[model samples]
Target: MANEIAGLVVIVTGASAGIGRATAVSLAKLGANVVVTGRRAERLTALVDDLADFPGRRLVVPGDIQDEQLAQELVNRAVAEFGRLDVLVNNAGLGHHSALAEMPLADVRTILDTNVIGLLAVTQTAVAHMKAQGSGQIINVSSIVGQRPFPHNGIYSASKTAVNFITRTLRMELRPYNITVSLVYPGLTATEFGQAKLGQSGGNRFGLQGIPAQRVGDAIVKAVRYGRTEVYVTLFDWLFTHINRLFPQSIDWILTRRS
Candidate 1:
């Protein structure tokens, strides 16, 4: 699985920071030609510099994932520069934290636009190229909240839930083309995600510490190499997801009490 990454061309969205940045670094180090995109050009450029010592080539195409043109350009530039696209990591997403009653409709639209619409736009563009080539991988970065939503995080959870279903459907639909679709459910990653959330400021009030963003990045890399259907960043994340599935009522009760 480790050697499988060398020379493969991979595109990572939200590559300016956090898990996306870490994933790009990991892929570059393993000798994968990486194309990184995000809204921040400076940060993306900094990421390219950080990977300067790695074996594979790197290209930065910074833009908002919500832009359909950017999505097309991302795939176009990758194929143009690297000649082939092997992996697409849909890690670009927006987080929101507000009670359903208090959440603004505008904010809801923004979250869905970036997390769901943007994801699909980029994926649809990549799928066309992958289908032509007959081989590729798609890794969508979801959150544990998608499996079990916490208080004040319903909107964000809903977006990831859509991603979960989309990934599963893609897996079946693209099987004939040998395009693998994988879902990554990462629990409370220690990144700017919480601080950068759309509403509310206190950050994870549950008193639980978050794992490093690099951990999720490594999981993404592993999923690409091994063709995993689903990847969880930690044992606890896997347990929580399954436990919620088996005992939804109990989990709901616990969460209600915690909130």
Candidate 2:
């Protein structure tokens, strides 16, 4: 795995904190030159500082993933600086905790813009580069909620659902180019995601305590090495996904009881 990752140029978005940040550091530790992007300049700078002694190089591109120009710049800069891109991690995303009836239309659009549209913009740009390279990997950060939407998480769930479809479709489309598409569906993780969703961070909405963000980061590395199409950050998330598939009504009953 180290041999496969070493010398590869990888791009990670939403890298200011949490899973994105952890993934960037993890890959850098394994000798992958990493380009890290997000909306927080100070945090990104701090991340670069943290990686000062990493085996591979790190580049900080602080900006919103929703910016198309930024997306293009990420790919261009990765190629120009690192020579070529070998991997792209579409981890930049946000979610709001609201039901369709009460959620503002603007918030819905915002979630879709960041989680779905922004992911696509970067992916489209990366695909162009990766296709030309003939061998590349695209790892999309989705969520377990994508497969099973719980109450009060309609908008966020919908966006992740879209991510699932996008990843699945691209996996086949990019196969000919030797480009692998993988999806990481995380359950609740210790990140600012909860704060972004519910306007606060400490609360655990899933009943289960969130796992460390590094867990997802490690999963990303494994997925890339093995060419895995789908991964769940925790075993529980994987089990739940399967349970939902095998017994939709039973899972629905459990969700209703919990909700």
Across 89-203, the per-residue lDDT of candidate 1 in tens digits comes to 9999889988989999999999998999999999999999999999999999999988888888899999999999999999999999999999999998888887778988764
Q: Least lDDT summed over 10 consecutive residues: which range in candidate 2?
A: 197-206
Taken over the whole model, the C-alpha lDDT of each candidate is 0.92, 0.87
TM per candidate: 0.97, 0.95
lDDT per residue for candidate 2 within 57-122, as digits (tens), equals 888877787677988888898899988899999999887765568778888888898999999999
What is the Å distance of residue 95 in model 2 from its true position?
A: 1.6
Predicted structure 2, TM vs. truth: 0.95
Q: How far does residue 77 in candidate 1 sit from its true spot (Å)?
A: 0.8
Among all windows of 10 consecutive residues in model 1, the one with the lowest summed lDDT is 196-205
